[model samples]
Structures are given as structure tokens and as C-alpha cells.
Target: MQEINSIYPTDKKECYKLILAQLKSLLEDEPYVIPNLSNTSALLNGALTDINWVGFYLLHNNELLLGPFQGKTACVHIPIGKGVCGTAVQKDAIQLVKDVHEFPGHIACDSASRSEIVIPIHYNGQIVGVLDIDSPFIARFDSVDQEGLSELVNILEIACDWANVR
Candidate 1:
């Protein structure tokens, strides 16, 4: 239960580095999934600016089920290849949307979310879930976010025990 109230570094790379370090410290020796994801969502929600939602959706029985999150209530289930989160798993890549309104199949779980970034989380060479973040500002996410969050997801993939998640 560490308190993180310091301002993030102005430089994006430095900020991500700090975030990664914090994530490592927070997740160390904690191999359980739910609590890990819960803390992870809280960490990102507090660290990132202008984001309205920070959460995870896990793959189960061929669909994505809502997992731990930090935000207003969200969509409970999403089919594969459906929305940004699903599409990330569908394509097995990161989905960085500058504007959710512009995406053809965007799901509006929250109307305030104008942008989103979803990174597919992999385990044992298979997609297990997604690290999903949303912002209220249009074009809030970009390449820097994609890269930084991708690294964060990588940390989670390594630190958590995916086999025990479901």
C-alpha cells in the first residue's frame, strides 16, 4: 500500500521507466492474478494523466470477460474481434486509437472515452487478455503510449501466474 503522489517526469520515456520500476516493485513476489491486475489497474490509473479507464479484460471460453479495473462501470463481455480490446486479441497486436469515434466497431462502454489503447497480453505463446486504457481527450493516445503500455503489459505477463488466473 505505497502512496505515489509525486509528479511524473516530463519526458515520456523517463515516465515510462519510472512506471515500469514501480510496477516491478508492486508486483514482485505476488504471483496471483486478480489482485495483481487490480493493483496494476490502480497503478496505471494513478500514474497516467487524462485517462478515464485503466483495466484488463481476460480471455475465457473464447470471449473476453471483464476483469479488475479502475474506472466507472464497463462492458462485462466482449466477443473476439469486436471492439478495441477484442480487436487487439483478434490481431494479436496493439490497438492504439486516437479517436474511438472513428473506429468502425468501437464499443462505447463510456461515452466520455474519446480515445483508447489496448495491448494484447500473451502467455505461453497465446493471447490471454488485454491491457485496456481509455481517455476523455481526443487523440490522447499515440505511439509513445503504445510503446510504454506495451512494456507495462510485458511486465505483467512475466510477473503474474497466468495458469492460475481463470
Candidate 2:
């Protein structure tokens, strides 16, 4: 792969395509999960606009534990089937909330966040964590963002070695 470019396209879908490619290049030779996740969070935090937080919540001891993240201080633990991150793990599906205040049992890690997206990260047929992003603007995340971010998580699932990640 060529050098990862900083020039992001104005088109969302096209930008996502480039972001996926950039992620691949960034993780090309790395296998350890922690550093990979750290860089992934930083990459997304920088690449995506209109977002206040981007991070990972790893499943450990039947709950979600805070992992590498780029944003303000966040809640350290979230139970499964609870908040958006936990619900994503419980449902094993992406959660896209246009208005977090409207979502029952929402966890407000950052009071500035109004919208959020969470995608379950699976490895070897079991969920290991979630990729979460938060936005300060209501409805900041849409289907396009979900699709693109999902692809990013897919790459993370296959690229990192999750053994002993907890």
C-alpha cells in the first residue's frame, strides 16, 4: 500500500473507501490488539468530522470495559444490554442513535454528545468489543456513517490479534 493520504474526499462513501484502505495500511504488520485499537481510535478521531468521541469498549467479565479512546473522560464500565455500547454487544448489531437523549438508559460519557454510533466487534465468532463514536450534533450519524464505520470495525476484527486483550 502507498503512503496513507491525509486528503479526504468530500463524498462520504468515497471517503470511507479511502479510510478503509488507510486502516489496512496502518495495520498491515501489526497484530497486537491494544496498540492497533489505540491507533484505530486516533485514526477515526482525525478522519471523521462532526464527532466528539471515538473509541473501543472491550468485553471483559461479562461487561464492557473502556479501551483505547479519543475524547473526554468516559465511563469506565458499562453492563451488557444496558447503554448503547452494551446494547450493541448484547444485540450483536450496530446501534445508531440520532438523539441519545431519546434513547432509554443512554450513558452520557460526554455531555456534549447528542448522537452516537456503536458497532460490535467480533473475532472467531464471538463478540470481543465495540467501536463507538459520538457526535455533538443531533443526527450527526446516518446510514452512510454506519456503513462506513461498520467496514472499519470489520477490518479491525480481522486485523488484530485479540488473544489476552482484556
Q: Where does candidate 2 clash, by residue pair?
A: none
- Deviation in Å, model 2, residue 107 alpha carbon: 0.8
Number of colliding residue pairs in model 1: 0
In model 2, what lDDT does residue 64 have? 96
Per-model TM values vs. the true structure: 0.95, 0.94
lDDT of each: 0.91, 0.90
The TM-score measured for candidate 1 stands at 0.95
Q: Put down candidate 1 lDDT per residue, 13-96, tens digits, no spaces.
A: 888888899899999999998999999998888888889999999999999999999999999999999989988998998888
Worst 10 residues of 1 by lDDT: 1-10
Count of backbone collisions within predicted model 2: 0
lDDT of 1 at 32: 91
Summing lDDT over every window of 10 consecutive residues in candidate 2, give the lowest-scoring window: 1-10
* Cα-lDDT of candidate 2: 0.90
RMSD (Å) of each candidate, 1 decimal: 2.1, 3.2
